[model samples]
Target: MNDISMRVRPGTATALIGRNGSGKSTLLSILAGLVRLSSGVLTTGRPGLTTGYAPEAFPALKLTAEDYLRGMGRIAGLCEAAGRSRVSELLATFGLDSFRSRKLAGFSKGMLQKVNLIQSLLIRPQLLLLDEPMSGLDLPAQHTLLDLLQELKREGTALVFSVHEPQIIEAMADDLYVLQEGQMLRTIHGAENLRSAPAVYIVYTELHPVAQQAVKAVPGVRTMQPAPDLSGISCTGLTVDQKMSDTCLQQILAAGGSIVSVKPLGGLGDLTEWMDPKDQIGSGRG
Candidate 1:
């Protein structure tokens, strides 16, 4: 499972996706040099291209979170003063400033996770390796980390991580690589927004008679029909994407429509199946 090879360019966020036991963690550990690679070459830009790794398991330690982060920065060649400054900055960034001096042994799972992420990010490493940094964080904390990673990418960092959530992958990744059964099945490069091409869907619902006309008036909806019960209606429309689907549905409900269900009209096998190529408008799905 670990004999795979690939390349990632700077300034892109690539998602490493796979089910458990598919070697995602092992691959990350090998990349960080924490585990020995049995064969094949693994290379990177010259030394001083700082690299930081946050393992999936937050290793237990006796030291305070602040100390651990400062130590990592120092080892990465930051002077004592600079290391301390960097650690302080990251502690605040992850909202862990209050717990900075607390011992790791006393920290909650989420608190320790905040420390793990901060330690890796404090140095502003050129190559950032995060193994599920958002694992134990709350929703708001997840957003914070995601925003930070996007900002870091703008500064020329190469970010890569493994995640199980499709929604996060949809929101954050510029490239999605699917790993299955010890092999990389596909590599998809492009933003999720780009994938939100104009696509058609078949929507069915039971709406108030007045609401039926309102749903037909919904901008993206192309057509509608009454079912035999006359209490329900069907809508066919060009939608922006999955995200917008919810908003359009909400509009129907707000207008007094009771939605029965929504199902995409295409299969997921084709790269462009979910998106309507006509609405792509050069934003690109590469």
Candidate 2:
């Protein structure tokens, strides 16, 4: 049930995207040499050709984030003097200076994400492969990472990474590969689909058990779901006949429940349909 073949040329930014368990991470690991390919050849230009890799799994043992990055720098073959300077510079750039001495065990998910990114960027490599590098970052942090990628691209570093968010793909990726069932289904020629808003929204609220009850009273709620971890609840397959989301938002706020986030159900336009849509024309989806 798995198959993929890609020619990753130098100086190109490629994105790998797919639903959960579709093998994005597995493909990345294969490329990183952390895992051996089952039946294919992966050849690189040189034995010493630098390649920076950041995988999701981290060491469980006690160690500061700084310690890990410093070690990576040394292992990548930078001399002691350069490794020391590079590690310090990367830690500060990724906003982990305050946590320099803090053990990785206590780092928040977001902090761990920053450290993951920092390690990959600490020393300039000929190729950079990131696996969901922006998973836990705030908006500002995401922007910072995008800027860093742009810098790398300008310097002729070939970059490939995986991301689920359309916004991330729209803003950062130069090309996209959509994968499913471990097979490469499509290589999108343009990035237009990423900029369009989802045709439908599923709103979730904070009141939980009560919120579920009230939403049922609302005529537009077509489906109800218990939130992950039972944090609250959500509604989906909204009744199309009414203006439900705005009304639902008001009702939830009045009931002392806050809107957690809106979920996008795809009706976003096709990536090929728009040579240019006015609303998305200048925002730079491509």
Candidate 3:
């Protein structure tokens, strides 16, 4: 990374956007203190500021999920009892309580990702850095994690994450940073400017099978899919026309469906096109 300067304030979310090998992950690592900066100065709001980092690829270990979390808590300076309690709480919150005793080596990609997040959250750090926090999660899991992060933001924790998902940037980002070849290409302060056109809105909902059919019958719902267990519908990419979005949402709510998130279709498009000179809106120095 070079000539990159940014600030993360309490209770705000910062998003890093870039193509592969553009140094997004490297920037996050530098913020997490995992990588040393060869030049430039780094400062924080307070000295010894606590920070947490969740990586994209989680390791598959022989240890059980519970053991792994507890070990992480201990490493974060929690006492034995506190570590055990925190482990149990996080496992239950992530709906992995039953799988606590299961070996991490046997866990699926989604499950391991949950463990990865749980470990980083062990200390309740003041600053959190996530390298693709939603990498391997399903819609429901992603919703749960988003809700948790929203709550953390409300509680005054600073969040900085690198992501390619437009939905995530729409839902969580307060500031957007576009990087190119280890340089700070542009910075957009508010995420609202990310939307190019309001043509389609992607709606996420959890509903019973009967409600699922009702939603499918909605006039403008273009696509949908069912949840893994068939307990509810998990729309892979439920694209609804902009004009019908409000009415469609109302009908889903009327049918007792829980709306997780509704985001515009093409808010952030292909990363390469972000450098277009004509697309400048909220671009500025950090």
**Winning candidate number (lDDT):** 3
Model 3 scores a TM of 0.70
lDDT of 1: 0.70
Q: Which residue pairs collide, candidate 2?
A: none
Query: Worst lDDT window (10 residues) for model 2?
Result: 277-286
> lDDT for each of the candidates?
0.70, 0.68, 0.80
lDDT of 3 at 48: 84
| Model 2 Cα shift for residue 266 (angstroms) | 14
Per-residue lDDT tens digits for candidate 1, residues 102-148, read 88998889988888888788778788888877788999889999898
The 10 consecutive residues of candidate 3 with the worst lDDT sum are 277-286
Tell me the spans in candidate 1 whose CA falls farther than 4 Å from its real position: 45-47, 192-194, 197-286
Q: Write the per-residue lDDT of candidate 3 for residues 1-286, one digit (tens) a residue.
A: 6899899999999998766666777888888888898999888969889999998778999999998888889889999999998889888988999999999999999999999999989988899999988878888889999998999999999999988687788889989898877898888786576644443554555667787777678786776754343245554346665667787788778977666667655345434364232323443321
In terms of TM-score, which candidate is strongest? 3
- Per model, state how many residue pairs clash: 1, 0, 0
C-alpha TM-score for every candidate: 0.68, 0.66, 0.70
Rank candidates, lDDT, best first: 3, 1, 2
